[model samples]
Target: MVIAVRTKNTQTVSDYNCNGRHVFTQTRELERPLVGSILQSMWGVSPTHLTWSALHNSTLVDYSWSVGQTPFGPFSEMSTLSFAQKDAARRNVLLTSLNYSISSAIDVLDSVAAHGGERKLLKHNQYVEFVQRWSLFKYKLDKAVSALSHFDFELALYYLRSLDHDLYGAHAIVYHASQELEASLACFKDPPFPWATVSVYAVCVVAFIYVYMKRDKLFRNKRKQF
Candidate 1:
């Protein structure tokens, strides 16, 4: 989701685009596993007015950090610093997150090979790993575009340098990110359902996995909060 961060620059407020993507960010950067479970639950949630409005109005809360533009409730407060102090820290955080996602996605996919998990039944923890990889794939694509919005080119480069680790999956991400950049002005003009599309899809995928694969074991267990 594109959160236009309007900063009070004296009398004139300037709008700066900050993409707040907390789920994938938490998973990759903060090493949070519950983030994936949260996405899964959001997808299958029985839609109600409270849930809908909460998701709709809850955009990125942090303006200074490298938060991707997301509609889901995953964002956190920016690092404890002023906006200017956050610029460099944000870039580093983005870079670290991209690296972590790429590495984690590759490992999870490799672990889930047909022969990898031979246990007859599905394990909740194991399924959580699957959710993360699926999420990592989509998020890598969406975040690539969001990174560009916040001048996170170095972070992009970091992801590119490691493309060899998973070239096949990386192709879709790299390709989509380019198309997204080309369409940025169009998105900036109207946003055109960027976060809504990605987050909704993420929510659905997670919910499906939780219900069909994990069978509510995930929800029954208390998840650690971000």
Candidate 2:
């Protein structure tokens, strides 16, 4: 996720790379997150896509934003705006995208539960704990959305990233549950017969019968000679 932002003075965009991420003049710096999030969603690059596109195409919409222009929807509208409006637009883009991502992720978790496969797929304790953890995350997600709507980005960002540890736990629980399910399924599978052992026993029995028949014949001949 390397973003190189330069002013119109920069003719050769390819040659320049900066160590610090924030290279824009004061105005552009504030707009970076909003622009980045929308572009990431639209472009489907570096991270998850913002909007759905054709399976082969990375970008849902081909669009870019410029200074002093309202980057609204798929189309740009030229409008006059005070500094406050510009700030509001930036906040809206960032918070709205964050809300969408959180909702999508939570929906997947809920869908898994809705399938009624949790009992067969997950251990009793694991299923219970995962439900509890996801419930907590859902609560925080609601709080984060509320905070973002109220323009409290700092608190929203805090709550959004706070799911890191619980997310890891969720992943671990799912992995272990899948493994357990695989083992259980394997138990129901029929095992292959040991054909090699059976063949060896068959050969030994034939050889023993041959040897006994030969001995019996030899003894009859000896008795007839006597």
Identify the candidate with maximal lDDT.
Answer: 2
Model 2 / residue 41 / CA error / Å: 11
Give the TM-score comparing model 2 with the true structure, all chains together: 0.41
Residue-level lDDT tens digits of model 2 in 1-226: 5455545452222322235432232333325445545544654323211334679565564333333344333222233443544455556665666766567566656756654567766777988988877777778778877987887877877877776456657756766766555332435668899899999999999999998979978889999999
> What's the CA error at residue 33 for candidate 2, in Å?
18
TM-score of 1: 0.22
lDDT (Cα, tens digit) per residue for candidate 1, span 100-204: 666765654454443334132224554454454455556555657576566877666555444434444433433333343322243446547688789999999
Q: Show model 1 residue runs off by greater than 4 Å.
A: 1-86, 114-137, 152-226
User: Model 1, poorest ten-residue lDDT window?
Assistant: 43-52
Instruction: Give the TM-scores of the predictions, in the order they appear.
Output: 0.22, 0.41
Alpha-carbon local distance difference test for all models: 0.44, 0.59
* CA shift of 69, model 2, Å: 11
lDDT of 1 at 37: 30
